[model samples]
Every structure is written in structure tokens, then in C-alpha cells.
Target: MADWISRDDRLPVPVTAYGPLHLLARHVHRLSDTGQAHEAITAADAYLVIARIVRDEKSVRFLIQGKMYALLALGRVNEAYPLAIALLHSQRAAGSVLGEAKALCDLARIHLLGGHYVDCMRNLARAGVLLGTAPAETDRHRSALCSFATAATAAELYEAAAGAYEQLRHSTSSFDLVHAVTLLYWGLRLAHVGRSEEARSRLRRSAEITRAWLETDPDPTITAMHALALAKLGETTVAEKLARSVIMELRAGGSHQYARMAHLALGISLRAHGFPQEARREFIAARDLTEEGSRPDERPIIRFELALTALDLDSGQASRDLFETVEGQVRELWRLRLQRLAMLRQARQREETEAARARAEREILRDPLTGLGNRRRFDLLIGAVSPAREAPLTLLLIDLDHFKAVNDIHSHSVGDLALREVAAILRAHCRQGDEAVRYAGDEFVIFLGGDAEAGSEVGERIRMAVAEADILTDLHMTVSVGVATWSSGMTGEQLFQAADSRLYAAKWSGRNTTAA
Candidate 1:
């Protein structure tokens, strides 16, 4: 902590005797945003102490949120949880829907950092629902929702994110940095789901807006996002220059995480421009910069991009595995298979004993707890079902909403039974061609031959079936579903990601809803 928290360095002193409180508070905010969490915490705490002493609820609200945010950034979850609960209580007591929304968003953010995606989405959904039902949503409420939506996007809930950004874009009169960031996210999400042309258009608009806004508001984040968007829009040279500038600025500021992101963005631009080796180098640096304390949601995308760049690094096994992920491109895949066929030898094959052992090993793919296939089996199925080759393949990624809370409140035994019941419902409703897999604890996936509409119908049926099941004595299960059908230009991984994003959208729309 900094000396800003000394007894003599109180907010009252700053406001009345020492310096301007507004300037001090702004400085505190800048500290928090620029990754100086410990310093920000001290300043925020000092302000909070003075605000409470003076009974300034408004100042208290702002200062407390800043304090919690700093605590969150520092990975001090155990401390942040109780404070979050207290904030929610105070917000409700004050009859401020906006404040309550902020509290919920903070809790959701904590859950997100803890890798409790289901819990995060549930809290986020509740907050959105609460603010949405309010009789009058002023600019403040809209702004709060926009922030919530930004969190949703971070959680990979694209539909809710787009809706939130759209609302904020239309509602807010000011075209500032936040607006620029929102448009960038909206465009990025659009690209994630295979709307490349429209996404490019949006990205171009985002870049234009950001370029103009940069004259007054210079931020590395805006610069990085604009560069990535330009890369996506095929202006790789321009994107590289912009991303490099961002990396330089971020590195100078000690913003390692953003610097890492900038590295990855530049790698993407380099790769698009046919510089795979350069891209691999950039990706390597990006991966090296990641710390254990970095946000959980960022890890997956970072690793995914790193693997994509690894292909050009002459990495054999990993590259082969990654190449299989290029689903739906039949001719190329067949060519690769043919290239490997010459290496196969049948006469030196295993005997019946070895064949039986192999079969037994494959049989272990079923999840023992829920009687569904495990993640390995899910991966195998996705590998076989190419999205680019067959547009009919649909993926439905499902998450049991608030399952962690159930485990915490009831018992793990009850949670297991609830999972079993949910699995049974899924098994009962899945069509003949569908395969249900328990991807992870409280998370499941379904791969089927169907269109998006059929996938949605099946997802809804699964939801209804689980809601109707009562095998667990004290447990109830509700699931959120994200559906994605294979489309041209989409890889298997991208298809799965699309479904995952929809799952969050479902969770955001009040869990148990299906988003396709």
C-alpha cells in the first residue's frame, strides 16, 4: 500500500485543506486502470474512510467500488467477496437499481476471475434483468448496463454483448473512448460467429472512430483493438504499424498484460500478411508475458492463438493436432490423409489381445459420474465432424447454471445427483444422431447433424427436460445452451467457440434460455 492511506492523508483534508478531491480521485482511478492496484487500494481506502465519516453516500459508493475493483485486480477474492455482498446490501437499502447492478457486476467479475463462468453469468443475468425491468432507465443505468455488457463480452457472451453495446451506442450522446471500445468489441464478436464481411465493415467504422478519438483520448487499449480490427479487415501493414505503436506505449507504461495482448495482435497481423515465423516469434513473446494473476478469460484465447502460430514453427505433433481442427475442408484433409496412408502397415498390426485392449481403452471415454462421454470423446467427435466440410454439423455447449452455488449450499453428493439428472435429461432428448458429452464438471456439449433451428429446438427440449426432472431430492437443475451450426469459413474450434458464446448469451437472457 502507498502512503496515501496515512491518517493525515484523508479525503476531507484533500477536499478542504490540502488539494482538490476531484483531482485526487481521478488520479486514484488512473492508478487503478494502469495496473497499480495496491496503490489504488490505499488511495481508495483513505477516501472511503473520509466519505463514511462525513456520511457522503455518493462518495462512499464510488470509493467502495474502486476499492473492491483494486482488490479484485490483486486476486484478493476472499476479501472482495464479503465487501461485494455488503455493497449489494447497501445498494438495495439505498433503493438504487444502478448501484445494485454495479454490485452484481462486481460479484460476477469475481466469479469470472475464479473460473466460475456459470456463476458469473448467472449473477450478470440477474443484474441485467433487474436494471432492464426498472421503470425508467436513465443515462446512468444505461451506462451501467454497458459496463455489464462489456463484462459479458469478456465472458464470451456475444449476443448479450451486442445488445448491450447497441443500447449504449444509441442511448449515450457522447462519442468517447468507451464508445470506441464498445464498437470494437461488437465487431470482434461479429467476426467470432462467422459474420466476417459485416464484421469487417464494423471494424473499419471502429477504426475510423478510434483514429478520430485518439486525438483527444490516447489509450493503448483503443490502439490495440483498432489494430486488430484492421488486421481482420485485411489491412495487415497498417494493422502491424498500429499494433507496434500500442506495444511500445504499453511496454513503456509497464502494462504487461496489454503489452502481451498487443504482441498477440501483432502476431495475428503478421500471420495474415504471410509472415508466419515473425508471427510465431510475436506469439512466443505474448505467451511469455502472461502471469498467473492475469484474468482467466484471457488464457484460452491467448493459448489458442499461440497454437495457431506454432504451426509455422515446425512443431510436428501439435501442428498435426491443430491441423485436424480445420474442420469442413474435405479435399485438403483427404489429401493429408493420403499423404499419411503410405506410412501405414497392416501386417505388423497388433493381435486380438492388443485390439481388445485398445477397445477397452476407448470404452473409458464415457463419464463415470454422469454416464455421458467425456471431454476426450467430445474432442474426437468434433475432429470427425468438420464444420467447413459439412454445414449440417451443429454444436451445443451447455452449462449448468449456478451449479457451484448448489454444490456450496447443498452438498457435493446432491450436486452429483443433480448432474446425473441433467445428463439423463440430455440423453433422453438428444436425437438419434446426437452425441452427448460431459465436457467438464457442470459443463456439457452435444454434437449433432442438424441445422441451427433444429439445434435450438433440441437445446430447448434439453432445458425443459432437465427442469422437469426431479431425481435429486433437494437439487434443481437449469442449463444455459449455446448453439452453433457449421458454416463456411468456420473451423471446428470456431464453431465450438460460437456455441460457447451463445451459452453465455443464454445465461445473460435469464438462464435456461437457449441462444443459437
Candidate 2:
């Protein structure tokens, strides 16, 4: 066993079996960090054996989760899923909310890498809820770290994540520096979404905090992230200098992943600042490093960057070849991603269908008697069709005159019948492109897609049709209509306001009228 451990380059085991299991996990982590994934897997298997023999549940669970994490990190997520599920169940059964949350977050990260955004969001939301209820300080820190990881994968969640990190930054003791680096990650994402000023402020604080921590003990990842933020801020010269220093350290230490990413950043920054030749060299170096490290997934990004550089260099054939290669890889990736998405969507549809079948779902704004849209739906329809300047649209507001007399003279059921008949008349006469909505108890709104005159013609046609329809023998309903057309300077709200004002004017002038 000692010889096996020595051959594996793992730490010497103490007399206690659990000690060896712990050391083996650490050894596997180190191997993985250095890009020796095959060796890491071998060591991880050995650790599992020791963990089983030790019969310590905590050590065994920790080793198993670590092994699964390493597997996911190496892009073997299919193999990691069963292990992750088992870990999650075990943690939950033990009331280890923090552990369960962390496991969920890790699973989410794997899904994110595979482009399963919905699944990723589901797991992240669960983890966030559990983290909110976690009791201990250590658990809170762990949860915060997981939250940061999930947020980093999905850029849309950057603002919420930044707030979470800010809260955790003040409370956490362990991995304080790592937390600072995580904040920088969120800051970069915020910057990508056009929040440049906010991003710059957060990044500046993160760099200051990280630099202070690194003064005592250097972290290559923090240095690389800082360089990336500087690049985003357009400080290309300073960013390039920092990135080069990280690259040298990574190359010397045999950390190919960090070196590859750093070089890619340097290449992009150089290109942005008009150093095409140096940028090409850096991109090629990044590509070579990733290829040498045998990371196929990382290669596509580097190849895409190389193709872009070739396009700039005026090498059309070379650029085309690189683009074709990237296109093929992207198609394959998208195929797998779509297959996973279809599975998730099918599952969600089944759940929704079952739930929808269990009850008569009520539409909040529906006419209870006629099964037509009510006033609320009408307002929503009007709000939904607010026009852009590029497309001219028209609105028609119609109100039934003396509607109260129908309810007062006839039974409520007869009044309801008359209203339903008038709604049908409006619906039948409106063109296919026009939307008719019940605006109030006895009023309707129509949105049309034609010029002003056409809209007025359609309104008249609806009025004539309603006049011809016979619902109740003694009831006659005449609709007062107002037409409003959208112009380049109008917004949706303004259009509605203008149309509504005209509608009231028409009603006041005469009981049955159409005014533009």
C-alpha cells in the first residue's frame, strides 16, 4: 500500500485508514489541477477503495462528492450524475441542507456547461432557498460559494448574485480572497450586459481586495481574473502586463488551463488595441496549450478566436476552414444540448398538463357568462399592442349606448345574452388581423393594422353589422366608436389616451357615432 501510494505520488498514509482516504482525495485534486485527469481518476478509484474499507461515513461521503466534482470538472458529467444524485439523497436524509445545497449547485454547474439553462435554474433556485435557511456560518459560506458558481455560469443572474456576494463578503472568514475573486467574475458579467460603470466600480474594489490578499500569498486565478477585468475596462497595456505575468507562472508550474485562458485574454486585449501580430501569436499559443492539455471542449473557443484573427489577417481560405471546423463542433454541441432540452421540456409539459387537468383554471379577466374576454383582458390587449415608430397601428374604442336600460328592463340573463350577441357581432365583422377585446361591462376595444381610413371603414362595418344582428326582440344596442392612429412620436400609452379621449367625445356628441 505504501509503494502504491508512493507510485501514485500521494501523501504517506498514517496508521489510521481514514487518513489515507483523505490524503488520496487531496492527491486526486492535485492531479486534476495539473491536467492529469487519467491519473486523477486512477487515484480517485483508489481513494474510494480506502474510503470503503475505512467505514467512516463522513470521509466516504466527502470522498465520493469530491470524486464526482472532479469527474464533472473533467467533462465526464454523464458519469457524475448518478454519483451526484446519490450524494444529494444522502445529504438530504442526514439533514445536511448545506451539503445538499452544494451538491445541487454542482449538478447545476454540470447542466450549465451542457447548456441546460432551465435545469440549471431549477437546481440553483433550490440551492438558494436552502442556503437562505442554513444555520451555521460554515454552511453559509459554502452556500455563498455555490451561489457564486451558479451565477457565474448564467450571466442573466449577475445583479442578484453580486448582491449576494456583497452580503457574504462581509460575513465569511474562510476563502475571503476567493470570494473577492468571485465578485470580480460577477462584475465582468455585469459589464457584458452594458452596465459598464457599475462593473468598473465593483471590479476596482475586487482588484484592491485581491491584491492585498495576494501580497501575503499569491493566487494565479485571482491574478488572471483581475487581468480580465482590466481588459474589459480598456486598460489594455496594464491588463496585458498582468496576464503575461500569470502566463509565465502557469507555464512554469505546469498549469495549462490557467495559462491557456490567460493567453486567450491577452490575445483579445492585444487585438482590441491594434496589435494584430502579437494577438495572433497569443491566440496560437493558447490553442496549442489547450490542445496539449487534451481539453477538447476548451479547444472550440480557442479555434473560434483563431478564425476571427484569420479573418482580420485577410486569409480568407484559412479563416473559412477554421470557421467550418468551429461550425461542425457547434452543431454537435447544439445537437446534444437540444436533445437534453427536449427531454426537460417534455417532462415540464407533462407536469403542467396534469396540473391543468386537476382544476378549472380561471382567467382573472374573463366574462363569466359569455366565456369572452372581460375589461381586464381588454386593457392587457391594448397594452400589449403598443406600437413602435417603425410600424403604424390603429385603435378603435367602442361603447354601447343605454346599456343600463337593457339590464334594468330585461332579466340579467337576457342582458347577458344581448352582450354576448353584440360581442359576436364585433368579432365576426373585425378582420383577421384585428383584435377585439371587451373593454368594460358594455364597451369593447379593437386594434387594427391598417391606415386611418381603412380602420374607419372597418369600424363602420362593425357598427352596421351590430345594427343588423337581432339578439333580444325589444333591445337595440348602438355602439359609439372612436378611431385613433399611431404616428412616429406616439407610445402605446399615448395612443390609448388619445383614442380614449376621442371615444368619449363621440359618445357625448351623439348616442351612435364614429369619430376619428
Candidate 3:
């Protein structure tokens, strides 16, 4: 397990002075740093008790922020809502624009997890306005934007959500556990929005990237996110182990909020695996953490899910009441969802039409004969290739061996057939994100996006494929491939020249070979 998501990219959050809020934060950080969820929650609760008795608005807000942060870190969606809603009102009363926006965003998060799309968007819109009106750029703007993105995902506004998350996942502070937990929600929302595979990819990537930090110390939220992703992707054994491990870690840590969320995640995974009884027990454990007045909306959330599970198990009165209470609301929201989706789809029609037209225009850069992108297309690609932290792009210059001789003996028609066949082979080998181009007659260039290490493997695969296939029966063909990876200082011309030099080296060494 790699310990770094890159040394500089994901360092540990710096420890702060241990005020009650800061102390709670330090313990709260343990959810990711040490998996001490139980302790964190207990500490927060103790703090809240003192703050409520003292009842100073400033102190109350401070304590509430600390506790709310703990709850959110633990992924306690239901438990967090009532406090979040109250915080929103309190912040508005304080006339702290940034705090109010942050509060609105937090409330949106609560609604989002509850599947309250309308409420989520409503809060997001109001938050966005407050965020915009803020005199200067602040963390509240960023937080509000994240909530907007989450709402977009919950609303199944995929295009917007996709774009929003693409920016957010890159922009958020990776070292912060709260930000890391948001990644879980980002992934869940992605899955709910019908981008399941995308969600799996993202979550697993998060796991792989965070494995280093997690290996050094256990983090319930990251571990849980990883487990959930793996389970969704059908890696049941490993995922189950990871998910079950969270309970032990949470209990050991003794953080109420983190324990609640961990159980909730485990319960969802269990439900997916057809363990309704096990799932119910996990959900109940999560719900038991709630105080009567903490989240009145909590029952409907759990009950709705309980009713579904009860259908397969022995559902009780609570499940029936929840279903009866929430069923109409769920239906109405779903109805609104369909309407929203229809309008979104309609709005996209013109956008799609414009895209199609642009695509047609771009096709002018495609080679008419082989259907691979032509030199013109390659030029555009080269121009777009800023030497940022993109994948190390490999340029493979593939030239047909003894091509002039083939035309001399077999006729240009046969030569054309060979070129077309080679193009077809390139097309077959490349996927959606890979780029293949006809650089010139008898010469092709392929840009293996981020697959630089696979240069030899890809070349070998293509060479063997060409060797095995007969474009014109009994007329065997081979290609000499030259590969060069782009370096930070290299220009497009330099990259092309390096690959070209390798091509010549291949030609000189052997008629049918690859040189890198």
C-alpha cells in the first residue's frame, strides 16, 4: 500500500491548538487519522452539553460547528440534518454571509443524502446567491459550490454534475478528512445519478490513492468508501472484510458520529449483498446514536429503507409507518425528477446538435482513405498538449516495411489495401481515449494517452496482430514502430523528431521491428 497520494499532494492535516472546538477537531480528525470515531463523538457530545448550559450564541455556534463537522466526517446523514437546519437559521440571523452560505450548503448536504432533490436544489440556489454576494472569495464560496455540485448529482443533472465534480475533486483539500468524506458522497451521488461505472472507477481510485495514508493509520471513512466501491464492483470478499473491519475500528475509536456512518455504509453494503437481517441490525445501530430531538426527520429516512428491507424480511410497524409517511413524498420527488430530466434533455438537444455539427467539421481532419485522424488532427492535438501534469504522452511513428516494393510488385491497389488494413488494425487496437492518426502516406502516428509504459506492449500487440492477419491473402505485411514520450521541456516538433529518429533506427536495425 502506497502511503502517499504523492508526498506533497496529500500530507496530513496540521494539528491545531486544543481548544474545546480544536480538541474536538483533533479527535474528529481521528476518524481518518486513527479510526477513533466513538471517542470523537463522545467528546463532541460532552462539549455540546457544556455549551448548551452556557448558551452563548458564539460559543454555541463554535460547539455546533465542531460537532457538525464530526457528524459529517462520520457520514451521519440523518443525525446531522436537524442541527444543520438549525445552524442555517442561526447563521442567517448572525448576518455572517460566509457562515450563512456554508450553513445553507450543509443543509443541502443533509437534503441531498435524504434524497430530497427539491429541497437540496432550493438550498443550493439560496446558498449560491449568498456565495455570489459575498464581498470576496472565501471558503464559503467553495463550500457552496460543492453543495451545488452535490445537488446537481442528486437531481440527476449528470452533465452539470460531471463537470462540477471534475473541478471539485481536483480543487478540494485532500489532507482534510472532511473533504475526503465528501468524496464518498460525491461517489454515491454519481452512482445514484446512474453513472455506476464512473462511480466505481472514482471510488476505487480514491482507495488506491489513499491506501498509503490508510495503511499507516486506519481511517474509517476512507476505508468504508473503499469497501463500498469494491462491493459495488463485485469484489465481495475483500469489500466485506473492509466493511466489517470498520465496525471494530469505530467501536475502538468510540466516535459516535463516525460509528453511525460506518454502520450505515456497512448496512447499505449488506443490503446490496442480500443480507437483509444483517443490514437491518447495522442501520439500527446507526439510528440508536440519534437523540429524540436531534433529527426528527431521521425516522422517515430509516423507515423508508426499513420498509424496503422488511418486504424481504419480517418488517415491523415502524417500517410500515415510515413507508406510509414517506411514500407519497418519494413519489412526488420522483415525479419532479422526471419533469426536471425531461426539461434537461430538451435543453441538451440543441447542445447535442451543435456538438454533432462541430464533430462533422472536425471530421474534415480525418484521412478519407484510412479513416484515421490526419496530420491536421494531429496538429490540433499537439497544440492542445500543454506540458502540464497530464499523462506522459507517447508518440509512436509506425511506418510500413518495404511499402514502396509492395506497390512496385503488387500494384498501388494492393498498397492502398495494406494501408487501409493497417489503419483498421490501429483502430481495432485503440479505445475511445486513445488517438491514432495517419501522419502521411505509409506512416501513422499514435498518441497513447497516459499509457506511456505500455509502449512496447502496445507495439508488440499491433505487430503480432498485423503478422497474423492477411490483408491480401498470402501477402504478409510488417511495420517498424518508433516510440518517444513527451518530456516537460520538449516541443511538439521535438517529440515528433525523436519518434522519427527512432523510426529510422528501427528501419536500419531490422525491416520489421520497434525502437523506443
Candidate 4:
């Protein structure tokens, strides 16, 4: 070993220093994987100094970020946050978009592990947008990072991450090992969201990849993930065996995180296999190890799991004590959320109140019964516009073809429902910037934001939706629509008049079509 080390001077310095960091990261990851978090954190600190001295800033940043992730994984979130935030800020300042995205992704993962779902979502969204702007060369790393972040948040968000990973997978145009791991992450996320069959399929593919790799170079993390996949697939015996192997490897190598995760997997497998006593012991050990190095918030989940296990063990007092602690923490979290909600509600109310006041002021210029812009408001708007600023605008006038018959055939209740249904159809079909109003008892008007062709399309769509509405299942209902565009010298009133005349022509021609 000494002779080989001396002979490999070219491979020694950078490889040796970085090799330990890699090993430490893998160890921390395994400890996290196995639920031996106490041991993982103790081993993780040794990599910090060497990681800082790496010549490549990007690689070093990722190394430190991975350490922070491990810290969080071990439930050491408070310890992770300051360093994570500083690294993220530094990456952002350096204009390393991909690095910044990765940092944010890590921070989000910490929040997620701590069960801060909302914060996790916010950070994931930010990271996603930044990662979108990242160059293609970094796509694989970003995709994996984002997938992890998304999976940690909520199962529903995993689809987005999966889509990103798919894009990366296709762009890379290779059957990379990381792609298989990503598929496994996506599978677990799918299971969380109740897509069991699809999850199983993906997990099987992931297992195949890991198995192939393990044939040549066995990695404990890969084995651990395979165990999780097997467990998810309901292969309890196989999962347990794999988990045991992973644990042995971790113990042999003094790898904390893998051991912790392996313990967690073993506990799950035991519980599934009806070994309650053994399962409880493993769960307790896993929980204790996780809590040993984790943040206060992170500890709650571990505590919660432990409490549940205690309940299952019929230890009433222990369970009750754990519940009380959980309750207090939950209440604090609720209070903070409520405060934020209250502040948002107050701000929204203020804005709405101001909007209501403005609407009230404007109401004076609208027709009372029809809620349409009164002639005065139209006159004011048209008069205020200079000829130089005038652009093409279309107006549409609509009329219920047999509204009087509707009121006569149906009671006023049905008649009102019919009118409201038509109004809703109009509202739904209209463009966002367009305006629709009840012009009178049987007439409606629309102010279009664009040219005659666009207005004609809007008029047609509204007519179709109204015709299709099931408001009067017994009666066949339809409307006459007319569209007219303002020419170079036309006034707004002239436009309305032309549209109205065309509407009458439409009623005369067919009583159920648009006239353009």
C-alpha cells in the first residue's frame, strides 16, 4: 500500500484530499439512509476543511452543500441553515446560477426534512426557475437536485421534478446511472402520491440498475436505495436482506448515515413482517439517532415516530408524553402560519376595500339595472382620446332572441336563471381584458380590446357556449350577436350603433347567429 501510494504522486494530492470528502459524503448519506444519524454527524465534520481547499469553486460549493444536506439529513437543520444560507448567498453573488439553484435546492431540502412544507415549496419554486435558466451542461445535476427537493416537499410536486429529470435524461442521451437513481426518487414520490403501480415499475427499473452496478462495485447507498425500492414493492424478505447487507457495510466502514437509514429500513421491514418487538426497538434506535444531531424542528418528526412506536408498544405514559411535546410544537407552528395568513388577509382586505370604493365611484357612470357603462362614461372615454392615439377597436351587441317568450313560458325564477347562465357563459368565453355588461332587459354589450376578427371570434365563442348551456333543457335557447369595428373616422357611439343595427339584422335573418 505504501509503495503504491508513493508511486502515484500525480494521483495522490487532489485525489486523496477529495477522496476523503467523497467518502465522508457517502458515509453521511449512508448514515442518513440507515437512520444512524448520530454517527453520521460526528463523521461529517471531518470533511469541511479539505472541501474548502478544493481548487474548483463549483465542486467545492457542491461538497459543502452536500455536507449541509447531510447535517439536515441527520436532523441538524439549525446547524445546517447558517452555513447553507451563506453558501447560497455567496453563489448568488458570484452569479453562479446553477450553484445558487443547488444551494436553494439544499435549503429547501432542509426545510422539507424539518417538515416546513410551505417554506420548502417556496424555495423549490425559486430553485426551479433559476435551474431553468441554467446551461445544458449542468442539467443533470440540477435535475437530480430539483427532483430531491420536490420529492422532499410533497408528492404532488414530484411530477414537475420528474418532468425536469426526463428532459435532462433525454438531453444527455445516455443511460447514466444517476438517471436510474432519479427514476427511483420519482418512483418513491409517485408512491407517496398514490400511484402505486407506476411507482413499482420505476422502482423495479431502479433496482435493475443498482444490481448491475453492485456486481462490479458495490455502493452502500445504492444498496440502501434498492432496499427502499424493494420495501415499497412489498418484497419484505428481499428488502430486509438487502437492508441487512447495507447495515453491515456501514458498520464495517464506520459510516453513520447509511447505518441510520439501514436501521430505518430494517425497522420498516420488521414491522411489515410482523416482528413488532424487534421493529419497535429498531424504530426507537433510529429515532434516537436521528434526534441526536438534528434541529429542534427536525426532532419533532423523529419524536413523533417514536411516540407512535411507543403507542404501539402499549407504553401509555411514554406515548402521552411524546404527544404532549408534539402538540406544543404543532401549536407553535400553527400560530406562526395563522399570523402569516392574518397578515395576508389584512393586506388583501385593504386592497379590496380600496377597489370597492373605486368601483362605487365608477358605478355612477354605469347603467343601474343593466350594469353597463352609461352613455356619459362612454362619451367621456371617447372624447378624452386623441385622434392620433386612436386604434382599431370592435364592439359587439348581443340580444336574447326569445327572451320575452322565456319569461312567458318559464316562471321569473327560470327566466332569471337563464339570463344569469348566459351572462356566465359570456364571462367565461371573453378575453381577460375584454368587458361584458348587461346592456338592458334583453340586451348585452361587449367592448373588445382588439380588431374586428378577434371580436368576431369572441362573439362566436360566447354564442356557442350559451347555445350549449343546459339552463333550459326543455327549451332550445339561442342569442343574436353583432360585431362592428371602429374605422379611422368613426366615433364610439357610431360603433355601438352599427353593432346594434347588425344585431337586429342577425335576429331578423336567423335569430340564433352572429352578424359580422
**Largest TM-score belongs to which candidate?**
1
Cα lDDT tens digits for candidate 3, 1-516: 155745566545543322334444445445433546566667767766765675545546655665665676577877788888788778777667777877776776677677675566666555655555566434545655665565555455544555544555565544334333445444554554456777776666555655655777676766765665565556766777787888777767666555655665677778778898988897787777654222333344454555566655755777666555556665554456567656544544544565567779778998988999998998988777665645678888899998999999999999999999999999888754688999889999898875556876787788888878798876999999998888887777888899899999999998688888
Per residue, candidate 4 scores C-alpha lDDT tens digits across 1-516 of 688878875644455323444665666667755767666556655555565676444445545655675676555778898878888887876666677767777777677667676666566666655555457655545454545444432323434544555665565634345556556655754554456898888888877877777787678976776776677678879889988887777756865545655676676688788776787787676565663453233344344445555666675786778766765665565455445434434543554566567778789777664445655665665464343446557788889888888899897778877777777777676674566777677777777778989988988988887787798669667999999987876766677788988998998898889999
Q: Mind giving the per-residue lDDT tens digits that candidate 1 earns over 130-186? A: 666564447667757866876765565544655666676665636344555545655
lDDT per residue, candidate 2, 1-516, as tens digits?
Answer: 777977897655455523445666777778776668777777778777777876756566676766776786677989988887888887777566777778777777777767777777667666665665566456545554555444443423444455556665666645455456556655654453445788788777777776776687677866776676666567778779889888988888877766876787798789888777888999899877765554334565566667667767765787778767766665565455445445444544554565455434336766775565677776676666544556558888888888888889887788788888878877786664576777678878888878899878988887777776677676777888888998876777788888889888988898577888
- Greater-lDDT candidate between 1 and 3: 1
TM-score for all predictions? Answer: 0.50, 0.48, 0.37, 0.39
Name every residue pair that clashes in candidate 2.
none
lDDT (Cα, 0-100) at 271 in candidate 4: 72
Q: Stretches of candidate 4 above 4 Å error?
A: 1-123, 138-206, 292-516
What's the CA error at residue 268 for candidate 3, in Å?
A: 38
- Give lDDT per model, in order: 0.72, 0.70, 0.68, 0.66
Global fold similarity of model 1 (TM-score):
0.50
Candidate 1 local Cα displacement, residue 44, angstroms:
4.7
In model 2, where do residues sit more than 4 Å from their true spots?
1-55, 113-115, 139-144, 147-168, 172-206, 214-223, 244-246, 261-265, 292-516
Better-scoring candidate (lDDT), 3 or 4: 3
Better of 2 and 3 by lDDT: 2
